[model samples]
Structure formats: structure tokens, C-alpha cells
Target chain A: MKLEEFKEREKRRKFLKEISVIAIGTAVGITTYLICLITHFDIFGWNFGLVLSPLFAGYAESFLAKKYLEESTGAVSAFILFIITVVWGFIISNPTLGFNIITAGSIIIIIQAAIPTATNYFLIGMTLAIISHISGIFKKITNFFYKRYLQLMGKLNLDPRIIREENAEEKYHFYETEPDMNHLGVLLLTLEYLPQGKELIDNKGIYEKREIFTFNQREELKSMRKNEMHLKLMASVKKTETKALYNLIKELKNDGCNAVLNLHMTFETLGQDKGENVRQIIVRGTGVVLADKTDS
Target chain B: MLLSSTSTLDNKKITKYHGLVNGEALLGTNVYKDLFSGIRDVVEGRTSTYAADVQNARDEAFKSMEAKAEALGANGIIGIKVSYNNLGGTMGNTILVTAYGTAVSYEK
Candidate 1:
């Protein structure tokens, strides 16, 4: 089989396996909930099976498979239990039709029950109003502390005085303000202003930001360190972390290395007249040339 | 010679083991530079002079380790670890950086 076809088949198999696992877990959870209802099981005036079956089933599946199940998979089991609860409530409310065998009238009754009632609308409206008011107050209170907390953490150096509305035409530098800004904001800003964005100064010169290397902190580091062969050591100190990493990658690529390992990066005060912060990135991975395996 | 901190090399078979190799570098700053660095540490929250010295020492140690591995007829070094120590005293004001790892020859 072709490589792409093989990979596609494998992916489909994996997806099917995951679905089966979730289905089994949900079935077990529902069975436990039914058993609890039939046995009248209760603990401390709470239905133990109803409350904990989904959680237990999800955990049990993960433990048995020797893997961490994603939160969505656990949610699937919980949602199934929720659907069972609704059906049980319907049977309790309309015992005559719900307990009876399937009929057109019973189907109609279920459809009617599924439709939102006037009381449901009122409850939803009140909940939304309460949530909006509470969230507005919460946002204001958190925004007040956010500046102070960031200052306490020594990450915020954004002086509002320096960013005057009158002098808003001047550029606002990210490096001078905060080393770690909202990464998504930086990405979007860069994308919005394309060719000139490489210089990192916007067209209007409003925000002057540096391109941050979007590397997976754990996964990329672990993979490169463990799997890549190293040939030469690459190290550089630049005005920005982006520059240092970018230069290191360029040098490594020039040396014919596909990956880097054992990276040690640090920020140090240059003690220059401007007291600029310089990033020192050292790559100690012995650069190795990956062999062409296709020929082999 | 290829040098890496990881214990193993990827996609390469070890043809020969050349045992362990090591390197050490000792560095000392001038008395005036040291004094200025100490003052700068108090005022600026960092001693750039000391930082530069440590960086130089680390590079020297790595270079020394690479030479030692080469001398042992090894083309690769694995499981490398670096350590830094300050030999403190009036006369013994020195910084020592040491690097050590296993040297091996791998398939080309």
C-alpha cells in the first residue's frame, strides 16, 4: 500500500478504537445508573451511583487502557448519563405513556416535552441577565488587580504616562514593556501587516514587536533532544530572544542539521548605556546529518 | 566530533565505545573587574563581568571536552554534563567549569 493510504487507514483505526472505548464506558455508566435506580441505592441522602458512575467509568477506562483519556471522552460518558436522567424524569412525570410500549401518542408526548416551555424561557433569560451583570462586575474587579498583580510579579513595566494619547503616533515597543506579551495578539498583529511585519514595526509604527519563536516547550524539546543527532554546538547572544533563537536555527541549518537538542537559553542585563536585556541561547546538540533512509 | 547532552544518538549505531572523556576550564577575573562586578551586583541586580567570565569558561570547557573526545578516537560524545564551581578565597578567587561525557564512534 502507498504510505499516505497506510497512514489514513491507521488514523481511521485509531479513531474507531477511541469511539468504541467511549461507547463501552457510556454503556457501563448507564447500566450502573439503572441498577442504582432499581436497587434504590442512596448514601447520605445522595444517589452514589448516579453521582459517581460516569466519573468512575471514565477513570476506569483510562486506567485499564494505561493511557490518559481526553476530557471530551469523559464528557461523552457524562452526557449519556445526563440523557438517561432526562428519560427517567419523563417516565416519572408521564408514567402512563412513558412506561407503556412505544406508540404514536408517546412519541408525540416526548417531542412536546423536548420543546422549550415558557418557564424554560423565563429561567434562561434570568440566568443570562444574572451571568452578564456578575461577569461585568467580575471583569472590572479583576482588571483593577491585574495591573497591580503583574507589577508585583515584575512582568508589567507598561507605564501609562509613557503611552500618552497625544503621543500615540509614536511607536510602542513590546521588548521595552514586557518580554512575554499575549502571543496570539503578536501573531495576529504580524499577520495583519505582512511584508513590513518582518521588520516588526507596524505600517503606522504603532506597536513595534519582535517575532517570538512558537516552539512547543515540552514536546519539541523532548523529541529533538532524544531523537536528533547533534553535529556542532551553536550559541548566540542577541538583543532579543527571537533574534538569538532565529540566528541559532539559521546557523544550525547552514551546518546541515535538521534539529537541535540540549538548548540552554537565558536573559542577561547587558550593562550597556541603555541597560538593554540580551538573550543568550546556547545549543549544545552535536549536529548529526540524517541519513537518507529511502535508499536503504 | 559530535557532542550532545542526551545519552543516545538517533538513527546511528554505535560501532565502538571509547569509554569516558572529560574537560575542565579555570578562570579568574582581575581584581579591579571583580570589585566593580561586586558593586554592580548590588546596584544593577546583575554582574555582567561575572556573567561573561562564566560564559567564556563554559565554552572553554566544552571545547576542551571536544578535544579530549577527539583524542580518544571517538566521533561522538553522549550523556554530557557540565558543572560550575567557585573556588572562593583571597588568592583562590577562581571559577571552574567542567564537562564530562561518554565517547563513542558511530556508523557514518
Candidate 2:
């Protein structure tokens, strides 16, 4: 596909993907919030939106800015993400606020905001700005819980090279959001599943680069759960997140790779260590992209 | 015919005001589109076939309302009110939309 076509396709795909994440995260956050109300069990004293919104907002800003680096991005990027999150929080709470624009009550609310809400947002902003730079003991603490969660969930064995279970929750959220925004022509992959060859491949059953797969064909991918190759390939992608898969595909196409080459290069290298085989899956249009920074 | 959802017309003199004119639209969906929309609801963050379908139904209702006003020899309608009703069993597959306004002849 031409560069313009690719960009439009990717924009739509990313937009769709981000929206699904936001929707699902919001749903879970609200559900969790309601449960908290009923049970009076407040974990860390955070409302549901407060807990999940920042992570999702960060994920989305990283998407729009087309920049994401694990624990390496600077304050500016994190700051931008925090602002996005704050705005989302404001919007989510707006309806409940019931502001009467020109009243004394509004003034009192503003004063109250300057004291608590503003302070809280400021602190949260600072925390988010520095979140990506967490290191030393903080990093170790994070990694410990991460790994333990995964182990508890029976996804991974106890390996010392560890660092994750928020990931499990994220996927559960993703599954809930998948159907609503499924159209935007994105080739979505997850930590658990690979984009199987058979599902993504066009009916021609032949792999050729730049061939547009119909939406129905891409839709078929909803059932393309991971096999051994999918899991193995996911591990080989250097970066393990969904964005990494998007970027990898972008890199392949930028390097002028055909579909056959894209599949082989994507799956084969990842499967090399495991002696795993790649299945045939064809997808149309380059949907979502990780940042394709030419300078890097 | 001119249309305004607000109560008063801007700097216009009303020569004759007719009784309330109304239009109603009822719409349905096929299995495939509904199924597609059901999946779309889960997978998408915003925008859906159902939203589009409802918008279309509302537009059709508005058009019919305007047609009624025009047939009554009124140049404008004001203070329009629109209400939506879901007629289908529990899940609300069918929708009913009703629009009403005071049709009037006015001179600006």
C-alpha cells in the first residue's frame, strides 16, 4: 500500500483500538467502583476510574504521539499522558458534578478544587511524569508483584528473569472491548494470541504483500487464538506488547517485504529457538502502527 | 418550511399559528445488520450501526414533520419536541420516533 493509504489505515486502526480500550477500562472501572460502594472495600482508596484511567490514558497518548518506550520515555511524554488522563477524568466526572455555571456554589466548588482536586491532580501529574523512569528498588518491587501475579494466574513458571499480572487484567479488558470496535481494519495481537496465518490470509490461500484482505477475512481473526507458534513468536518480538507487533509489521513493510516474507520474518525468527511452525493467516491493510521513527 | 427547535422565532411576526403538527417514524432491522451491530457494540469504542440507524430514523421523522408543516401552508415550525421510544421486546430492536411542533405562517 502507498504511504498515505497506510497512514490513514493505521490512524483509523489505532483510533478504533484506543477507543475499545477506553470503553472497556471505563466499564471495568465503573463496575469496580460500584462493587467498592457495596462492599466498602476500597483498595488504595482509589475510585475505579482513578485506578485504571491513567494507565489507559498513558497507553493512548503513547499511541497518538507515536512514541512509547518501556521505562525510558522522558518527563514531557509522561506529562502529556498525565494531562490526557486528567482531562479524561474530568470528563468522566463532569455529568456527576452538576455545575450551575454562574452560581455561588460553583465558586465554592472551585475553591474546594484548588485545595484537594488540584493538589491531587498535581501530585498525580508528577507521579506520572516520573512513572516511566522508575528504577532501582521501585523497579524491583514492581517486577516482583508482576511476576507473582502471572505465576498465580498460571501463565508463567517461576523464573528469576521476571517482571507482570496487570497484563492479564488488561487482556481481559481487551476481550470485552474487542467486538464493539472490531471494524477498523486493525490486525490485533495480544500477549496470549498470535495472528494465525489461516485466519488472516486471503481466500487465495496465497501470501502476497500489499494484497488487501476484506474486513470479513480480518473479522475471522477474532477466533484466531494462539497456538504454540503464536506464543513463541510473541516472545521473540523483542518488545512483547501489542504496539510492538504493530511496529514490527510497519518495519517489515517499510523494508518492502511481501506478505510471505512478512509472515516468515515475523514468525520464523521468533520460532527459531522453539522449532515451531507458522500457520497461514492473511490480513488486509496495514492497520495499527507503533512509531516508525526514521531517526531511530 | 423553516424549522426551529427553540420556542420563539428571531425578529419575526407571526401572522397565523396553526395547531401542533407531528410526525412519527418506526424502523426495524434485519438479522444480519443486527448481528453485525451486536458484534460492533462489543468491539468498537464509539460509533455503531445502531447509532446510525437511529439517526436515520430521526432524520426521516423530521422530514415527514416538515412535510406536514408545508402541507398545512405554514412557512415555519417552532418549539419542536422530539421523543424516542424503543418498541421491541426487552432488547429494543425496534424504535419509534415522534416529533411535534407548532406550525405557523410568519413575516420576518
Candidate 3:
């Protein structure tokens, strides 16, 4: 064969290899997205524009990886591509399906396939089946929980900010604000379920201790902590809390609340202290009031 | 010396502030570390409810910026910036993080 012809053949072979890698990656991504959609009924109700996001995202990601990694796109990269695809799929899907099951299944399959004695064909088939099955089940369960929670929230006259799927691997953090101070009273009215005050409220509608954080008390605490590390901490805390509060207020505005009367921050803390730092800060003025009137 | 491969004509210096580095590797050291820490915080319930989504947005931004830098052939990214915005009415939040730096080709 002529030297130029040989070079052309080599180039074509390299091109084919690159194309195959991209094609495989795209296939994995698309299949995962489809499985998630099939099991999640809420996803089907999403706007068409949102549904196409994962497809486009997957194609772009695969193309980019192929262009850059070329023949060196290792298994790790492929896995990362899979993760990226799943995340994008969740984002694009309506109601946002949690990826814990999908992620766990993918990891398990990858680990199994990495075993020296594992057969390639067996691994591939097993992984594909497991991924599809888990993805579908997770989507269905998540959708069921989400719908139930939303319905409950609607019935309670309480707006649910986020409806996270109940999964063993899933953790939730929520911050809410009481704009009219009326909600504060209501929260206190139902303090039986609250974390700190859960044990305080009895059937008689009485509490061991009625802790309230008024708007004025909050401002005073902020002023006191102005020069301390607590100030910075409070600033960051309030930023997120205020956001959650703002969103809640927007939802409740038509129902009558001019301003957020108070704010509540609930999060899980790490370490042996279970978030001692946060507890110390919030406990300082746990029941203080910030403002009185809705306009205030 | 048959120097047939020396095809250097006009090279432009592209300095990207907070551009991506590590070749095609996505996520700079600081950005990745910060992102993981944020994620950890969310997982640990140390953050507010929206922190997880915020962290995800931050991660996505880093990935996006890295992709852009890769397209530009950048060596390292510096001067990174991250910002957040909320799409009201239960749509959740959006985070925008940018990494930029100069793209340079070193001659050996």
C-alpha cells in the first residue's frame, strides 16, 4: 500500500474509534434519561422545552469529551459522563427525580465490571438491566411521594416549598419564614411537631416554654453579633433563610402577609456536636420577636 | 535537519482571567474543593434547604466554565467568580460561577 493511503487508513481508524466512544457515551446517557422518564409520571407533564434539555446536554457533553479525550476517554471519564447525564436529566425532568438509586446502581455495576474475573458481556448486560430497573423504580417512588406530599400540603393550607423524595440516602434541610407574625403564632400553635418544642406542647394547647424570636429581638441579636464571627455566620444564614422566606412570602402574599414576621432555620449538623455552632447561635435568642405588624 | 513540521506563523497571546486549567480536565482545584465542601454541607444538613441546588448550580457552572476554557485551549484559570439568583415561584435557584484565565502555549 502507498504511504499516503496507509496514513489515510490509520486516520479513518482513529476517527472511527473516537466516534464509537462518543456513541456509547451518548447511548448510555439517553437510555438512562429515558428510563427515568418512563418511571416518573410527573416528568411527562413537564414542558417540552425542559424535556429536551437532557438530550441536548448529553450530546454536547459526549461530543466535547470525544473531542478532547480522544482515544484516552477512560472508564472513569465514561462514568463521569454518565453522572453528568443523570444530573442533567433530573434538572430537565419535571419535579426533579432524585438520583440516589441510579447513582448507587451505576457504582455497583462499575465495581462489578472492574473485577478481574468478570465477563465483559455479562457485565454489560447486567449493568444495563440494573440501571434501567433501578432508575424506573426510583422515579416512580419519588413521583408518588412528591404527589402525596403536595396534596397534603395543599390540604393543610401550608405551602410546601420543596417535596424531596423519601429515600434512605436522601437528607433534607429546610428554612422557612413567617411574614405576618401570624404564621409565627400558627407555628407555635402547632409547635408539637417542631424539633425543639416537640415535647413542650401538650394536648391542652399549653407548652412548657413558649420560645419566640421577634423581629426586634433578631435585629438586636444581629447588632450584638455585628463584630463577632457570629455576624458573618448570621449574614450567610439569613441570606439563605431570607431567600426561602421570600419565596414563601411570595406564595402567601395574596393570602395576606406584607412582610416576613420571623424566620426559621432547620438543618442537620455534622460531628459529635450535631451542629453545636448553629445551635449555640440560634439558641441565644430562640424565641425573640423581630416585628409586630405585617407592614413592619 | 528536515524541519518540515515547523509551521509557526502568527500566535496570539490569550490571557483568560479564571480560565480552566489541567488541559481538558474539568474543575479547578479551588472550585472543586469548594464545591465538594458545599455539597457536603448540604448533605450534612448544615445549609438551608436551597443549598443543595445552589451547590449543584455551582458545580454545573464550574463544569461549564471548564468546557469553555477547554474550547479556548487554556492552560490555567484564575480570577473565578460565583453568583446566585432565585427564579421565584417554586422554580428554585440558579447559581452562576465563572472561572477565567489566560491561555498560553509554552515552547519547549
Candidate 4:
């Protein structure tokens, strides 16, 4: 969408959220290991390093899932690492651990890491999935508790959660009514892109149009609502690269989306009618001004 | 029940041991779901149908296992190991799942 707005959205809050989640995961993992080491570390049947690998793998995966989103599913890279570790074990064991390669001693020791790695494969998948799920729950609980606390604090002349909600609500806006052409901050940008050579003009123009809508166009709707979901989607944009408006929607949400107006692009084939190297494009969407009261 | 696959739940003390309990289940799917999920994989981020399906099967297996523990008067389940078995390609293309764990009651 709006590259600048998207970049701005991505630059701070998402990064912080990612860091916070990863930090939480890292703390949980490392603390568990530290506690295990302090207490029943002897319970482990295999090398302690084996235990550590999978624990950290799952820990790393929590962040990986967040950072990479859908790309992190199945965690194929971890699988690749498993294969590499096994092969690396085959090559280095005789020299490193003084065991003949492929011998029972080597195999057993290798199995130590291999077993945990394999087990962690399942563990990591499930753990990451559950971690995401749990984080969502944690967020809900925190919001609930925080809201209650804020209300109580307000009666006692406190401003704690109030400030927190303010900061969280800054980037978001909501509108009840469909922003027609008359609405302030609503700009329908009709962009035409003519392809030069075989390469289509990149989405830079589309991104700019969105940025214009966000910082300049969006600020027009200054009054806020608690929910931004009431903001509607009306984009006619399509990309051969994606199934739905997947990227557009995600990027919009990621980039402090006030609302998403469907991108409509029209190509002019008149002058260059059927010219192999020439194509035109247009983009359209509503930039609604969020109303404090009833908008409709 | 305090279910966990980890060797121990974080900070949650395990006060006693109550032996082990297990549950196993096999689930089947139709060609339509399998085909749609296959196509969906290419289109979306997660195949929610398959995830829900597998999760439901796992939950069922765990529930049966918990039922066994409940019968034994146990309060919690720990150190659970879950495994998947396929009865397909000739065995009717069914999915078999097993959940086994030590049943125990732990103090807060």
C-alpha cells in the first residue's frame, strides 16, 4: 500500500512487538534451562547439549513464526539444519569425539542430538503454534486487566492505562459511514502506469498513493474510535503474485491502515493499442475521515 | 488437566506421581477436503481446515487419555508424548494418533 506509511508502521511498533515476543520466548526458554541446570539437570539421559538444541530451536522458532509469518510454517530451515547436523556428525565424530564414524558409539552419541532434534521437530512445530496461541490469550487477558485497572485508577485520579490505550490507539482510526466523495481526507487517486519493455512499472506509484492517503489524507479524520475494523475494504487491485488481496491487506494493516479502499487500476490500450511493451494502470480507494460520533 | 509435552511445566511444581495413561484415535477424511486443502495450501498462509482437523483428533486422543487418568483419580497429566500413525496408501488412508503421558497430581 503506502510504502511510507507501511514503512512507518513496520519501522517501530511491529519491530517492538516482535522484539517483545522474542524476548518473552527467550526468557522462558533460557530460564527453564537455567532452572533445569540448577535442579534436576541429571534427569537428562543424553548430552545436555542435545537438550539445549531443541529448547533453543523452539525458542528461536517463536520469533521466526512472528518475523516470517506464513513463511515460518513447517520451519523447513530447521529441517534442513537437522539433515546438516546429521551429516556433519558423520563427518566430524571420529575426529572430534574419538569414535569411529558410523560405529555404534558414534551413532549413539549422534542419536543423542538426532533424537532431540527429531523430537524437537514436532515439539518446535507445536510449541511455536501454541506459543502464538498463548500469546494471543495473554494479550487478551492483559488488555482486560489493564482496562479494569485503568477504570479503577481513573476513579482514584490515576492515568496509567489511559496513557497506554492512548499510545496504542494513535495509529488507528474508525469510521461508521462509507466515506463518499464528499468526505474530508478522502482522495481517489487514479494512477496510470505505462509499461516500458517487458517489465511492468513497479508498485512504487501505488505505494505513494497510499502514503498520500495515510499521513495527509488520513489526518483529516482526526477524531478516533476504539475499533479500526469498522474501516472497510473497497480495493479492486489484483496481483498475479497473490491469491487474495493478501499482501495489500497485510501491508495495509501492518502500515497503520486507517481504512483500505480497493485499488482500481485501468489500462489504456488506445494509442499503443496492443503494443507489446506498453500498458496503463489506475488505482482507486476511499480515505474516510474517522468521526468521533455517529458517522453514517 | 495440566497437559504439557515439555519435560516439566515452567515453575509448576510436580508433587506426586500417579503412573501413566494413554489414548489413541484414528481419523478419516474425504477426497473433497483433502483436495481442497491441497489447493488451499498453494493459495493461503495456513490450511486452517487441516490444522483444525488434526487438532480435533489430537484433542480427542488427549481427552480419552485424560478420561483414563480421571478413572485412576489422577488430577493432572505431564510429560505427554503424542505420535501420529498413518494407515493410508493401502490401510484406508486413515490417520492414527496416540497420546500417552504420566498421570500425576501436583501441588501449586
Candidate 5:
């Protein structure tokens, strides 16, 4: 599709989404108002139920923005605040008071009557936005601690939904033949590590030939049993994999990727000349991100 | 075609090496299946349908990798690795399977 056409469609989609959010917010507001009326709840001569209208409206807007947009909470909240001000002003317009005041003063009096109502909504919106923003920060802190706890327990709880959406229309090149580009981006990683020393090394100079078993190598092997070395290698591999995955997440976050997909790890042993083998781990995956909501 | 998880075949010599090849398969579940699976877990202690679906996805991913290798004119694939991920959350409805390997031409 042409760029202009795509932009036009995106504009329309955003408009509709905003409208839906407003509708939901209004519903929550009206529900709260009705319950307040039924229960005869009041706070300092003002109906406490009325306060809930904008409070819940702001919460609903924040929740939707977090789940869908994920990155535009602040912008959406500001937009919703402006919209609610106008909407609440219109809803509370007193026709009798407007008619009475207009005859004595002017049409400006009618607008002046709506000012207090609009101001109340504006204050509520601002407070809600601030509260939501702080809550979002708390959620992030909690998630960080939770993930760290899981890692401490030797469980890597990586969520695939981190990349929630994938755009298949974009073209990606491959050396052989192009497969369906159902993912956002692709990466191939090869990690080489020394098992006994628990150290990582570069792949260079690996092809140099060495004797199968030197005396020093034999002594080292004798010091540590074959099974011990094997267990250590497995542990090292796990630790390396975890580190690589965390790095991938950080890189993808910078690249605006929501999640990783098609992730797999493969292992191979190079230079397996009796006890001096080099073990290599290969990690490959694609990134998936949120796509255009309208297109989906 | 000969496929092995090891880096080299038992006795065959590799004449040429092709780059990495990969395949991926995604399986989606419906609400009904999820509900029934929950009930089965409570009653039977197993959900056979999900297991079968996972196995099917793994097989499909392996097949896709093999096809990519064939397209590269490779007669053998080595160092094959397979991994599965649940897309969504703990009870996410989508499962993804990915398999990858190095393709090579080997002496018959």
C-alpha cells in the first residue's frame, strides 16, 4: 500500500480507537453515578459517586492504553483529559439556568456556567493521570524483582508474548530462498566457551591444530573426572544461555521489539581431540512486535 | 537426506557446508479446548490434546527446516536444535515450535 494511504488509514483507526475509549470511560462514569444515586452516597454535600466518574474513566483509559499501546500511556491520558473536559461540560449543561442567566446577561453566561464542571473534570483527569503513571512505575519495579527471583531459583521465565504482534507483509532477505517474513527481525548468535575454566572466548585461532593429549592436558583431565567436566560444561552452557537471552532482550528493547519468537539453541563440539574439545552453542531467533491495529 | 543432531556424520565426509537454515510452526488453541483441558487436568491429570498438538508443531518445524536445507542443495543437516515457546502468558493459547540446523553436502 502507498505510504499516504497507510497513514490515512492509521489516522482513521486512531480516531475510532479514541472514540471507543471515550465510550467505555463514559459508561464507567454513568455506572458510578447511577450507583451513587441508588445508594444515596454523599461526601461533604457532594455526591461521592460523581467523583468516581472521572476516576474510573481515567483508570479505564490507562488500562486500555497499557494493554494495547504499551508505549503511549502519557499521550493517551492527556488526550483523554481534554476529551473528558469537553464531554463532561456538555453533559452537565443546565438549560434552565442558561436561559435564566442569558436574559439578564449574555450567551457568555451559559458558557460561564459550564466552566466549574469542566474545571472539576480537568482536575480529576490530571490526578488520575499522575496516579496511573506512578502505578506503571511500580509495576515495572515489581516485574524486575519477580524476574530476578525466578532466575535465582534457576528458572528462566522468559515470556514469548513480549513480542505480541508480528507484521508479515514486510520483506526480509535470506541467502538461500526467502521464507515467509512473519517476524519483525532475525538474529543468529554463536557463543563459544571453555568448560573447565568457565570462560568465554573468541572463535578466532580455533582452527590451529594442537596435539591430542599433552602431558599437562592429561594431568588436568586426571584432576577432574570426565563426568565432572561434563557437568561443569552443562552448567556453563546454562549460565551462558541465560546471559545471552538477557542481552537479546535488552537489544530488542532498544530496537523497539516487543518479544522474541522462533528462538532455539543448538550445541556442537569442535576440536574433539580427546579432552581438548571446544563446545559451541548456537542461538537463533526472530523478533516480533506490535503491528498496525487496523491492518490486523 | 541424512539429519543428525551431532556436528558430523558417523563415517561420511562433508564436501561442502551450507549456512544456517531454520523452520518455525505456530499452533493456536480455542477457548473450548482451553476449558476442556482445564477440566481434564482437574479430573484426569493430563491433557492429551495439547501434547498431541505440541508434537505436531514440532514435527512441522523439523519438516520446514528440512525443506529449507533441500532448497540449499544440502544432502545432510547437522547440529539440529528444537525449542518451543508458549506465546501469550502462562495459559496462552498459542504455541510456537522452532528448529534450526547447519546444512551440508556429504559424500554418499
Candidate 6:
């Protein structure tokens, strides 16, 4: 074959590979969904929808994994689908029955899956069932915790207010602020530390500074900073902070404070690695005072 | 004997200095160091994405200031200070860079 033809063939092969992966992903998703729908033994008043949610979840997860994750497995997809099936089963079933079955089933499945066996189908199914059941329980617990968290935030005196001023020409200036002292002052000021890595450098030729173990090496960095996931998280965090600060500033202005002094401090903590798990805490404080010269 | 130009324009003493040159002249060693350090922090792991963003903001502010200085026929700017509110919550990580400097005209 000519060089150009050979290159074209290689390109076609690569294209085919990608297409096949996508096809496999779709098949895994559809098969998992169908399996959950079929194998669903409605024990303890669990409806079809509730039992089938996990299958749908698993399929969706598999599809996403195929698209995002480098490695895609039919077995993993099936397992995830099965687990979702069980979780949904618990969700729809009677609370007592679901919890008991899930807890017991999950332990058994986890143990069985951990062990190597030639006939792994039964063990895999059991493991998936157990995981789903436990996940359902977790969902309930997390939901409860989330509700309580919101309630606690509300009780912490987070009074977000909007003040509009109409000028002589009927022009209005709107000022929005959050007056929750606890939320703004205490909650955000705290910082979490992330550990990057350590390095040893000889300071023979350098200045008086002998040696320093700085976390500045590019090779030591583990977290992917420029990824879409990190960007989304950053955007969310920025939006929250902006809203809070905007509200606080507005409130201060409404209270007849003309001048505001904002002090920002950032400090790194010891231990932990980069990413959400370990982050530098930035503390920003806004002091609102009367614009009178005497206050200065 | 030297023949001096006896024109009325001679009294005006026109000194031609490019705006770019004037801006450079106005830059303090410390301010330049700080700017470089800020840029380095953005490039390094010491700073977050927000810090890089702030650095970009500062650079843009300086560029605009330079343009304004040129329009005003000022030779340089001094005593620059940048300040902005650090909003909190998830979004508080965003840093707003605001730079202000005194613009002055220098005679060459």
C-alpha cells in the first residue's frame, strides 16, 4: 500500500475504535436498564420504578464513564446497574425491610466480590445488591443531614436583604446585603491545608538561604488544575462568595456606613494534598464605618 | 560664534518623549518586582486560578492606566495601590484587582 493509503487506513482504524467504544457504552447502558427491570423481585412493597432507578443510574453512570473514563467494562457497568436496582428496591420497599435486606446483602456482596472465584456471577450480583441497599440508606442519611444543614444556616441569622434607593430623578440604586454575622464572619474565615510534596535542594551556589523544601515543583503536583471539573467547582465557589459579599456591602451601606474597609488574608495549612480535600483558606473581612473624617 | 535660533517657538521648549517610554520611566523598582512576583505566583503552584485571574486583572488595569497616562500627556504614574472586596462563601476565592497610581509629567 502507498504511504498515503496506509495513513488513511490507520486513521479509519482509530475512528472505528472510538465508534466501537461508544457503541459498547450504549449497549451496556440499555442492557443494565433492561436487566434491573426484569430481575426486580418486588420484595416488601417495592414498586417497579423504585427498584429500577438504580439500573437507570448505573446505565447513566456507565455512559458517562465511557465518555469520560479511559477504561470501560461491561461487568463494571452491569454491577453498577445491579447495585442501583437493589438501592431502588430498598427505596420503594418498606423502610424496615429495605434497610435490613440492604445492610445484610451489601456486606455479603462486598465480601464475595472481594474474593476471587470462577463462578463470580452470583457473588457479583449479591455485591451489587448490597451496595445499592447501603447507598439508599446513605442517601436518606445525607438528605437528613442536608436539611439540618440548611436549617442551621437559617438559624445562624443569615438575613439577606435588598435595599433600593430612588433618587430625585426617579433613578434607583439597588443595594443587596447579607447580615448574617455567623455565616460571613466565622464560617468562611477558616482555611483547610493541602500538602503537595517535599523536595531537597543544595544551596551551595545560592544566597544566604541554605535549603528549603518548597511545594513548587511541577512534577510533584498530583491534582489536575486545568480540568473542567475544577473549573466548575471554582465557578460555583466564586458565585457564592460574590453573592455573600455583595449582600453584606449593601447592608452596610443601608445602615448609613459610607466607607468600607476590606481586609483579605490567605494562609496555607500543614498536611493534606491539593484539590477540594486540601485547600488554602482565604479570610476576607469588611469593616463598615461612617465616612466622617473623625472616624479615620 | 554660535548662531542660536531666534524664533518664538524656541521659548516653548518642546520635549518629545514616547508614551511607552514615559510609562516605563514612571515604573518603580519595587512595583515592578511586585508585578513580576504576582505573575510568577500565577505561573507557580503558590497561587490558585483566582490568583492568576487577579494577576490578569492587574495587568489589564495597568495597560488601561498606561493608555490614560498617554492621553493625559503624563510621563509616569507613582504610588499605585490595588484594592477590592474579597466576597466569601464558595465565590470568595475570586480576587478583584484594582490599581490606582499618581500620573505625573516629567521634563527632559
Scoring only the second chain, what is candidate 5's TM-score? 0.85
| TM-score-best of 5 and 6 | 5
lDDT per residue, candidate 5, A195-254, as tens digits? 111122222211111111111235335423321222232233334443444455556656
Give the poorly placed runs of model 4, Cα more than 4 Å off: A1-296, B8-15, B31-46, B89-92
lDDT of 4 by residue, A1-296 (tens): 69998899887875565555455544544554455445544322322322443345444654465475432233222333333333433354333444233443233234434564655465566456556564786667766985775476456431111111112223322112212221222222211211111122122223322211111113212211122211111011112112122333444445544333223422221122221212122223332222223334
Question: How many angstroms is the interface RMSD of candidate 5?
Answer: 16.1
Locate the minimum summed-lDDT window of 10 residues in model 6 chain B: B19-28
lDDT of 3 by residue, A1-296 (tens): 69999999988987677666656655665654565556552323432222232333333444565576553433433454455545554444324444333543354335433642343444455446556665786667766985775576456433212211111012222222223322322221111121221222222211121122112324334432332222223233333433443344344343333222112223212112221222111210112212222332
The global C-alpha lDDT for each of the candidates, from Candidate 1 onward, is 0.45, 0.41, 0.34, 0.41, 0.47, 0.36
Clashing pairs counted in every model: 7, 22, 27, 7, 4, 14
Q: A32 in model 5: Cα distance from truth in Å?
A: 56
lDDT of 5 by residue, B5-69 (tens): 77556577666555466666655443333554555576455466567767877787788778878
Q: What is the DockQ of each candidate?
A: 0.01, 0.01, 0.01, 0.01, 0.02, 0.01
- Which candidate achieves the best DockQ against the true structure? 5
Local accuracy of candidate 1 as per-residue lDDT tens digits, A120-165: 4543554465465547866677668855654653442211111111
Candidate 3, which segments miss by more than 4 Å at Cα? A39-77, A94-102, A105-296, B1-108
Q: What TM-score would you give candidate 4 relative to the actual structure?
A: 0.24
Measured by lDDT, the strongest candidate is 5
Q: Which candidate is the best by TM-score?
A: 5
**What is the C-alpha lDDT profile of model 1 across B66-91, one tens digit per residue?**
88678768898776777765432222
Model 5: lDDT of residue A179: 33
lDDT of 3 by residue, B1-108 (tens): 011112121232222222112111111112222344464464455345345544554555455445545555544333233333221111112122222222223322
Sorted into a CAPRI-style docking class, model 4 comes out as incorrect
Give the worst 10-residue stretch by lDDT in candidate 1 chain A.
A228-237
